[model samples]
Structures are given as structure tokens and as C-alpha cells.
Target: MDKHELAAFLRNRRDRLQPEDVGLTSGPRRRTAGLRREEVAVLAHISTEYYVRLEQGRAPRPSAEVLAGIVGALRLTDAEADHVHLLAGTPLNHTGWHRRDVRPSVLALLERLPQTAGFVMSAAFEVLAWNDLAVALMEDFAARDPEARNLARRAFLTDSPEEGPLYGISDVTEFRQNVVRELRSAVARYPSDPAMTNLIDDLRDGSAEFARLWERNDVQPARMLTKTFRHPIVREITLNCDELHIDDGDQHLVLYSAAKGSPAAESLAFLDALGTESLNSRRR
Candidate 1:
């Protein structure tokens, strides 16, 4: 690792951004031109002392995960991310591997589950693919900007809808924490991917809630269980959330199903018809 280059890069990135750019409020009386070292350390989930050491070129070689965190914290672009990886001596070619595709079998499974709300997501919570029912119950992924299709991005970075449909559950705190924890895992797995790093940077800069949750440094296995949603058309429905991990692609097939003959099941059927109509109208 090029210690001098790494230190210079870290300092330069840190000096370019302001607090507001990262969802932090600038104090009434500010002395520094950019973000404080402590702020960067908090965003990167590292100690201020260690970050100081890094900036001074006195620290030991950082692990891939640490490099990833710093990359995200600094809002490094794709090229910059690669440069940081090289400086850390853990370079991995991330070109063309940034986004994973949904398998044909997974698409077939989604097609077969007409009454269920299902979608495929990447480790970074990017919506790779989704069924019509998912659109009916939540915002239309196809209609959103490609970058805006991420669950974590929308949940924390943007304002929650006032009275629209709920995605997983009505308990906002639990949902946000879960998303944050899962994203932490994704950062570790795809440290060299610019897209992942960019997403993290955006989240850290745009959402104080995300920054706070991320600072907890919690890691947990994503759990699949029952969840409640307040759908605008269906009112309220409770469903079982099943997450099938695609080990090869590191993606997840998330399906929500209600018990047969239950009220939620009936609501889901109604939603299917509504979703079909919505799809047909769009084609017109």
C-alpha cells in the first residue's frame, strides 16, 4: 500500500465535503472548512485516533473492510474507489460485476406467485427485479429512477410517505435498523464495488437516521418472518416474509404471502386484480 498516496487521498476527500452534504448540520460557529476528523471517523465507524493515524501515514495497512468504509465515507467515485483499493493493496477488479442479474428461475418463481408481493434485491438492497404485485403494494420500481430503486435509500434518505402503503412493516425503527445492518454486510462483501460505496456515501450524507443506525456497528443475519403492511387499497394485511438466498449471486428473493383463506389472503387477491389493471393501463 502506498501510505503517502493513501493519506493524501483520504485528506483530500475529507476536505472537499461539507456537513450539510452529508445530512449533518453545521454548527453556528464553525472553524474548519470541511468535515471534522471525528465526523469522518463516525461515518466510517472508526476511531478518530485511527483516522488521524491514517491521515498522518502512520497507521498499519488497513483491511479491505476498513478501506471500503473509508471509501464510502469519502463518497469516492468508481475510479477513486479503485484507486483507494490499490493504495490499500487489496485491489479487486469490480468492473461489470457491480450489479448482479436476477436468475431466470427466480423470475419464474415470481411469475408463479400471482397473489404474493415478490422482488429480487441485491446485497446492497438495490431492487434488481420485482413482480407486478410488488408494484401494486409499494411504489413502482420501474417508474423510479434506477438509482432510486434501493429500499435502504428510499427508507432513510427520503421522506416516508404520509399515508401511503407500507413496505414491510409499520414499525419504522425496526425496518430502518434491519436495512442498515444488512447494508453493513453488503459493504464488507463488495468493498471494491463503486456502486455499493456510492450508495453508502449517499445514505451517510443524506440521512442522519441512517448515520446513527450505522454508527451502532451492529451486524445481524437478515431474518425472515411475519410482517404487517398498511396497504392503501387493502387497508391492512399481515403476511409471511420469506427470504430465499441466492448464494451464487448473493441476491435475495423476497416473497410475501398471506395464509390461505385468511382476510390478508383475500386482500392479496384483490391486490392482484388491481395490479393487473394498473399494468394494463400502463401499456395503453
Candidate 2:
């Protein structure tokens, strides 16, 4: 919670990582472990002094490009990159997406974004309710399978021996990384939420990477995220995300948009079909 604590945590983690851990060749006469400040600077494409400023807490925030570079250089787990965002004060993650009572104005806005996939989420990262198109892209948003369980726990907790996952049973690294990053974005703002604490505990016990990411205590604000998703149903789709705060209520709405003439646009249309199915099933 405290900056000093954050700084210490960052330092401790940097020391724990080995050059080999990040695919760097271990040099002879390496008296200490982990990446040197200079090595991180070289990899991140920034000067050693600037990276030192970040590590020393002299720099209050880093630009998105710099943050990305730091992520690549430090091998900051998704959690760590997220932490950079939080420490930087980009914005609050909450968009009041799950509030039961939302102003008509906000709801109107959410409804108007027909070309984009959108939803309102709680501070808890609960997929309260998403638009027709949004549901199609994020399959989990469409799933009425369970409450209290989100993608993070589902992806990391379920084992191959159990119900089969689309990504196969073998240890999946990238999926784990995405989930960790997603969770890290939420963790920074609402650390005290018991639900989150429990979620992290389950993740820690379930995967080594999850445990490592959690231990770093990186807090990051999720904003304007542009990510690619490989949906089992839709193939690979890339979209730009925008999280908008509902000024009146605690809820917030997030929308994913693709270019007008792109494959992602087609995917958005497919999502509309899926949302119809979801509504129809409920009717039945």
C-alpha cells in the first residue's frame, strides 16, 4: 500500500530473478544474481539512470511506451506491469459496470455502442452485464455457468485432469500470464476485498506463476488496453478497449472497438448473434 513497501517489493523481486530466468546467458564471474540495472536498461532501451529512477521511486510515473519497455526488460510479470500503471496513477479501474441501479443516461450510452462490444463491470471485476457484442467476444461474459468464479480462477484453477480446457491440458504459460495480468489490474485498487484475497489465495496454490505474480504486489490501473484474444470460437481478434466511468454511480462501462473494415468488425457482428442467443435462452 505504501510507496516504500512498493519500492521494497520491486527491489526484492528484481534480486530474486536470475539472468537465466529471463533467457539471458549467465556470464562468468556473475557475483550476484538477477539482472543488473544496466542490463535492464539495455534490454528496456532506456538509459540506466532512468531505470534507476524508477527503481528508486524517483520517477512517479512512466508513459505507456516506457511502461511497456520496462515490462519487456524487467520480465515484469503481468502483475508487475500492472503495478507500474497503478503506481503511475493512470486512473481508477472501476466503471460501476455491475451496479444494480444505473442512471438512464449511462445505460443509454452503453446501449448506443452497437458497433462496439461493451459491458458494465463492478470494482470487483465482475462481468455484471455486457452488451450483445461484448458477450460474443469474451465467452466467459456469456457463460451463466457460475457466480463468484471469473476467468482468472477458472483458467488457473481448473486442471487438465478435470473438465478439458480449450487450450489443452498441458501446462499453459501464456494463458496463465494473461490471467495474472488481469488479476493484477484489479488487485491494486481493491486489495481489501475478501473476494479478491480468496481469489489470489486459490491462484497461489494453483500455479507457480500466479504465486510469483501475486507476491510482487504490483498494482496497475486498467485503461485503454489493446489486446489480442484468440477465442476458440472466433479465431484471433484484436480490439481497442476503453473503460469509461459512470460519473453518477459506482459502475463503469468498458467497450471494445475494432476498425470499421476489419476482421474484428465481423467478430463484433458474431457477438451480436451470441447475445441474441443468450437472451433467447433466458426467455425459454
Could you tell me the lDDT of residue 205 within candidate 2?
A: 84
The candidate scoring highest on TM-score is: 1
- Model 1 poorest ten-residue lDDT run: 91-100
For each candidate, what TM-score against the reference?
0.62, 0.48
Candidate 2 stretches greater than 4 Å from native: 1-105, 140-149, 160-192, 221-224, 232-234, 246-252, 270-275, 278-284
Off by over 4 Å in 1: 1-98, 160-168, 278-284
lDDT of 1 by residue, 36-114 (tens): 8899898777799999999998998887667766766766666787888888787554432334455678888888885
Q: What would the per-residue lDDT of candidate 2 be over residues 1-284, giving only the tens digit for each residue?
A: 24554466567767876786555787898888787888877766778888787778776565565555555555554456567557665532331112233445666776788688777765444555666666555544554543432546556566654334532313345545645666676555445444566777777887776788767765543344665766556667778867787644345687889888888888877766666676345434
Q: Cα lDDT for residue 47, model 2?
A: 84
* Candidate-wise lDDT, in order: 0.77, 0.61
On lDDT, the candidate that comes out on top is 1
* Per-model root-mean-square deviation over C-alphas: 12.4, 19.0
